[model samples]
Target: MHTAEELLKLQPVVMKQLQMIFEKDRVGHAYIFEGGKGTGTEEMMLFFVQLLLCENPKNNVPCGTCRSCQRIKSGNHPNFHQVYPEGQFIKVDAIEKLLNEMSKTGLEAGRKIYVIHSAERLNVKSANTLLKFLEEPEGIVTAIFVTQNINAILPTIRSRCQHIKFREIQRDVMVKTLVDSGITQSMAATVSMMTSDLEEAFSLAKDDAFALSRKTVLKLVEATFKNVHEAMLVVHEDWLPLFKEREQVEMALDLLLFAFRDIVAVKANPEAMCTYPDLVPTWKDAALHTTFNKLSAQLQAILNARKQLQSNMNKTLMMEQLMLNLQEGKSFV
Candidate 1:
């Protein structure tokens, strides 16, 4: 089986592209594997690289029995180099250094491959350095750029590479994956609405308190609100320096919307099923009605905050106010 087979299923187009690369032996020198997060683009790149380097390649997969496959599997493949953000952005010197590393003679494997997890993180200086390398890859060197936002790459870089668009795994595929991960079929269907990633599902599925808190609000159906402050604290103090505040806020709203959706559902029909079925009993009709206006206002507020963030607003204050409004009893706040 291909790498990431367990977590994601590819569309026919993507599979066809894989087969073409294997058969033609004309793997492009540069490629942009673009898709949403958890859609398995990164895993697909690694699998494809393995297929290219596999000595005893089979059915478009690298046969682990062979030495080449063994080396790649063991992370000892001399020809494979992956570069990612050591901090936040890929610096010019870092990429320059990676390019220099690629130029070296390798102990094994015919093709030298470099996988950049977030190609968008390349700052101007680093991007310019990469442009020079892409202008000329002298040998069987392949660079796979994985991105959720393909437009972030320069036009010069975009025009030079083969662009492969990847979509989300279908509902059925997501459900089956969740089931295989020991989730009941009903829960799988419920959580798949948010996302199908196993790691996410597992956490959400297990957190009954999180679900109830979300029902206290209305848009997203199963998102829990219990750990908002805690989660935000970690993101602010620990991850803010690493990931953009825009991303963290988006995640926060995702949780809020999901929770509020359950609140709406419970308000309208108490008997109806909710994403957080386990959290249903905690819901109160009075609370739901009182919170309705606040929920709508917060939706626009989060959107406005997101806009201000683009204009360089203070993220900590934006989040602090947003969370405070969301946490209070809908009427009193």
Candidate 2:
């Protein structure tokens, strides 16, 4: 669990606005948090709820050890409710039941807080039912909606709530945060380029398949730089077997693209943070021998393979062509 102050640093603008709203005693009945994944929207929502329900608070910060805070921390707070999509969408039945619960008196005397996660997954019927509750609710009701895409929400629903947008985490900040969490600098740097979300980056770094993909892609690059025939052999023997699935192939291409990009970066600056820091010496030698034009064309070949993958092109042929293109103007000496 993150402290309110920590969340504030993650989302300064949203935190400041929430603080002002709390201080003015103008807490609204509905709020919609809009942001990409790993943007701290969920954390901000929890902190906001704690501020409203905390038994003791000072300067708009909830006393995390208070009775109310403890209950909320344990997720047993009677005034708090959460709704998530059951399948493809949030059904009307779920909304109807929740609305009924909200209508009744609570076990505690305070505001009733309900959060709907992935609000965009609400079906038309359920969305309409929730909109009615949003229009007129029982005493001290607060509704919060969390979504990655706000445009998918109903216009009427959007009009009823205060919408807060969460910004993407900075790359350097994400790298440092991941490093502090005990992730390797090379892996943290690599995943940072793979995704903007810290949660997703963590997931990737911990995944065995992702690690294998990085290793295989680096091996392919090494073989390509050494000899075109060896690169083709690796593709048939290693690459094709490991990256058979469509998504797997895409991830492999991403790793390959970054590997070439590292070579280019090394040519310009020796100290550049690369996805595969272990290969810096090898890439440095290749960078010293290769022309930028050849490197750019090699990059373009990988990109073209990505585009061809979308068209359901034969993966084997696509990769073979990319290898040939990458081998052009190449010299290890």
List per-prediction Cα lDDT, in the order shown: 0.67, 0.88
Model 2: what TM-score?
0.87
Pick out the ten consecutive residues of candidate 2 with the lowest summed lDDT.
324-333
Q: List where candidate 1 sits over 4 angstroms from the true fold.
A: 1-12, 196-198, 207-333
User: What does candidate 1's lDDT look like per residue over 202-259, in tens digits?
Assistant: 6765667434433332322222145456545644554344335575446545654445
> lDDT per residue, candidate 2, 98-161, as tens digits?
8887777646887999999999888888988988779888788899999999899888788898
Q: Which stretches of candidate 2 lie over 4 Å from their true place?
A: 123-125, 268-271, 329-333
- Clash number for model 1? 9
Give the clashing residue pairs of candidate 1, or none: 210-224, 214-259, 217-260, 218-260, 218-261, 219-260, 219-261, 220-257, 220-258
Q: Report clashes for each candidate as comma-separated counts.
A: 9, 0
